[model samples]
Target: MSASVTKMVPAAVILFGAMGLGGCATKSYVREQIAPVSQRVDALEAKLNETDGTAKSALSQAQAASGQAQNNGQRLDQLNARVDGIEQRMAESQKKKPRN
Candidate 1:
């Protein structure tokens, strides 16, 4: 039992030493691994901002077009009413003329 215990103590020390030496990462090494991912995140954020700007512009244009269409519709209604009044006066003037 004593011989086995003495042999295990050295084996345990070597295993623990190897694990401790291999487990830690240097700051430079960590930065090298993370740099590409950071750049990708920044690029995606820029693209998202650009898309958001475009969407806002499109929304404003659509609102302006809607207002213009409504104005055109109101103008058409006024023109239609004037045309009806003119047609009624023309019919009355024709009826007053002699049948010839």
Candidate 2:
């Protein structure tokens, strides 16, 4: 019985050691599991950068359009003043003319 017990002890130790080592993750296995997630994160970052650039470009264009609109409004106001002066002169000339 003692000889059998001694033999079983070493076999049990070897079996437990193999199970413990098998349960541990290797470096290559960890890299394989994480690679896809890393690639997805990189892709999302790139897309975010592209979107940020587009938003900035749109804001710049809107600001430029707003400046042009203000310039047009000022020109329209100046033209309105000139037209009013011409109308006033025409009215005065009509009043000075003699009836046929």
Candidate 3:
């Protein structure tokens, strides 16, 4: 009975030892598991940088367009004033003419 009990204890120890090792992850295995997630995070960071640059460029373009629109509005106002002066001069000339 003692001999059988000793053999069973050794067998139990080996089985439990193997199971414990199986449950623990190795470094390479852990790295493999995390590789895809790390790649996705890196890709997202790159996209964020790209979007930031594009947004800055778009903002500058919008500012330039707004400035051009303001300049055009000023020119239009000046042109209207010149047209008014011309009409006023023509009216004065007509009034000065002899009655027809």
lDDT of each: 0.99, 0.98, 0.98
Candidate 2: lDDT over CA atoms? Answer: 0.98
Q: Which residue pairs show backbone clashes in model 2?
A: none
- Which window of 10 residues has the lowest lDDT sum in candidate 3? 1-10
Q: Could you give the candidate ranking by lDDT, starting with the highest?
A: 1, 2, 3
Q: Candidate 2 — which residues are off by over 4 angstroms?
A: 1-23
Across 1-100, the per-residue lDDT of candidate 3 in tens digits comes to 6999999999999999999988999999999999999999999999999999999999999999999999999999999999999999999999999997
Q: Number of the top candidate by TM-score?
A: 1
Give the lowest summed-lDDT range of ten residues in model 1: 1-10
Colliding pairs, model 3: none
Better of 1 and 3 by lDDT: 1
Off by over 4 Å in 1: none
**Model 1's lDDT to the true fold?**
0.99
lDDT of 1 at 81: 100
